[model samples]
Target: MYSPLVQPAVSGASSGSRESTRDNVLNSVLTHGPVSAATIGDQLQLTAAAVRRHLDSLEKDGLVEVKSVAGSRGAGRPSRRYVVTQQGQSHLGDDYLDLASEAVRLLQEISGDEAIRSLARKHFASLEQRFSELVPEDADLTDRIRALTRTLDEAGFAASTRRAGRGGKVTTLRAAQICQGHCPIQEMAGEFPEFCEEETELFARLLEVDVRRLSTLPTGGHVCTTHVPLGRRAHASLMAHTAQRAEK
Candidate 1:
């Protein structure tokens, strides 16, 4: 007899703990899939059985689906893989997705693309203003970048910053890269790339420096990357200050 896997709800078990585990499993699939239950278990340090139980729940909830991969040799059974469904992807962020998309489409139909672009710019400007307040006027570029990354992460972008080049008397150019691991409005942004453009412009204004977007998630890049030049003049001035301090 085939029996469905039953997860017992323990009276002593904390709902918060169970919810956290479920979220971790979902996030693992969201970030690193189409993957196998075994892979998810290894990444998340959950037992294989536990991972499958969570996967089953996710599948039942319409958040994940199983895919079959061909066996290495023709004789064996195909391997089962798991991938997030469209509904699953949407569940990861932006609850008002349909409404937001519809609103953008209606705005475009009513007022044209420029109106949509204007709205995007205006929307992102609020983010800029909020982030600007968090970073002090005297904060250096790195401090500003860190502050912006923190804000993005809190807003569910999973953003991080990294420095690329050496900054010294010998090196005149340096750059910082901001990588957003996820975008809440990736689907909407695909249809309205103005969202991305407006975001890039907003970033430049907030940083008070020129920045270039290298890639975006909507266009199939793994992450959204922005390149920010620390400026040769700023580097030269810092080097000069260092030399003056050494002379003193």
Candidate 2:
């Protein structure tokens, strides 16, 4: 019957979705790790069975390691916590990270810290130029934000945007949060935060609004969050322009 043909396709789709969920579980461990399965489930909204299935798979692949932590006094046995292995960390590292770090070190040795900062600025400037071109000249703040988010996502930063403020509406509060779930150069940036500083300035120029970086992955936060204040006076006009652009 037709049901026989559809059954295999449906099973394949479910398998693919589970595979994707396993990847998500690995990333969750990479970001906020040395955590318990229950904790990861809470953050990802997955059931304990689903989380355990992914964890077991990751362990088999040697991407995760488990540690037994002593429970409270008079409680049962120790709890099992999971953390990413060195191999798992390397999986998340940028392929060119070694070359980039060498280049930075050579620059520092040949010139000075100022030279390194200059190069960082130049590097981010190029990214800013590329991303700026994607936004229309007359595009409002929301469009600009969306474009930048897309740009960052394409660059492997896993960027996203959300309304944040008292009313939880961009029109009402005129502010939004830009969050980057991954940073390719996180380790390098920890030593030289000039990279972070330059990128923040680039975001300000591209968006034409004041932006504040609240946290970053290099700084031990789960995500890099930038607070962008859109100004109340232009809210209505910007929303109107965004709607017009959408219609066209």
Candidate 3:
């Protein structure tokens, strides 16, 4: 049973199997990202240790990233979720990126910049409305912001939220940072930044508090970060949007 030829064959087969399993794990993260290691193990029928091993390799290879998702109750530790990165997307065979970029260029040439802006606004309108329904009207800024990131995660943004800035001191600030680990329209957004701007506007309108873009995936950033000021009530923003809608 310990023959030399058989040893090579067995080693080759074991290596191939490992590679296959690793690929499967990466695909799962890409498809359902902002997903947890436990979820990945359940989906792929792999052991916890096995999933962690694959994830470590993927992270080392720049193929995946870990994001921290806040707990709903805000009482427990944040969960670590995995998302595929730009480099990972390439390995997944993103063949249409060039085509998408080309189409945006053509649109810009034919329709002008306002058209792109209008398209961007239209694109995020549904998201604004959806978030309105997803979060409670009485929810505070913190709750609404958390809901927003979760919605973005489901929409392929691979999003997460974390509290930032210094608190509990004189003249210090407490803010929330919404980080998007992936962007489905990274190429298109690069050509027409209206997409990103519109998203910011949407966040402002939905959260009723000011939001700022810290970085973006299109601008060579590994992740897109939006800076949101905290300690504001959602009702303030809600009333303003309501009045604006009535005028429309």
Candidate 4:
């Protein structure tokens, strides 16, 4: 029913393909969602009429949703807003999760949850260890967390950090979102045991942080949670992004 979002295609104007323009419009919507047609035209330098034409094609293909937003306060009539649909999102990336999911499924059939958990923990540990090494030894806890948070953001986790409680508390870095649509074998990683283990291991290596299984963590039913500490300035650099993102 629900498919992961796909990455936008690369378009070259010389190719003489309308697909490129359509793709551009689609990408525009994805980045600035629920946007008005006029707004889209203004940003892309396309006329309102041209924007409508592209939108028409996208709507017909079930790639986007056009909703009428009622004006707020003393505003005038409703304006149509466009958003990329889940289907279109799935087409955005190279499907790598499929293979990983398959392997995980096989592992579950042979070993069971205990073995999978052990493998996953090692995977996460390795990630933390690598990132920890990159952090400066002289830096305080804040600096260390910041460095790690930055690393996670670079790895594609929408991460952020904040100071909570009295005494400025500790810098708390939180990953608001993770884009795994393009992950190799993403679907399989959740469904199968071996694939799950591999995926966890891979994420650890890629992000250089421990990736804990959802079941093992306090996330309830969520698939997984990766932690990046935030007590030092060095760590804060990584965690600092959270504050920067919040401002935006």
lDDT of each: 0.71, 0.71, 0.73, 0.50
Order the candidates by TM-score, highest first.
Answer: 3, 2, 1, 4
Native-vs-model 2 lDDT?
Answer: 0.71
Candidate 4: worst-modelled 10 consecutive residues by lDDT: 215-224
Q: Write candidate 4's Cα lDDT for 42-149 as tens digits.
A: 666777887788899998998788767787575898878886665665565536556655665576679886656555555445446666676765665445445555
Query: What residue runs in model 2 are displaced by over 4 Å at the alpha carbon?
Result: 1-21, 24-52, 55-89, 168-174, 232-248
Query: How many residue pairs clash (N, CA or C atoms closer than 3 angstroms) in each of the candidate models, in the order given?
Result: 0, 0, 0, 53
In angstroms, give how far residue 237 of model 2 lies from its true place: 23
Q: Write the per-residue lDDT of candidate 3 for residues 39-78, one digit (tens) a residue.
A: 7787777778888999999999999999898986887999
- For all predicted structures, in order, the TM-scores are 0.61, 0.64, 0.65, 0.46
For candidate 2, the TM-score is 0.64
Residue range 1-248, candidate 2, lDDT tens digits: 00000111111115658876777788766544556899778766778888898899999999888978788585899889786665665577668887888889888999998777788777665566667688879988878888887787667675667666765455546678887767888878887887898788677766767678998878776568888886633345544643343233
Question: What TM-score does candidate 4 reach?
Answer: 0.46
**Which candidate number maximizes lDDT?**
3
Which pairs clash in the backbone of model 3?
none
lDDT for model 3, please. 0.73
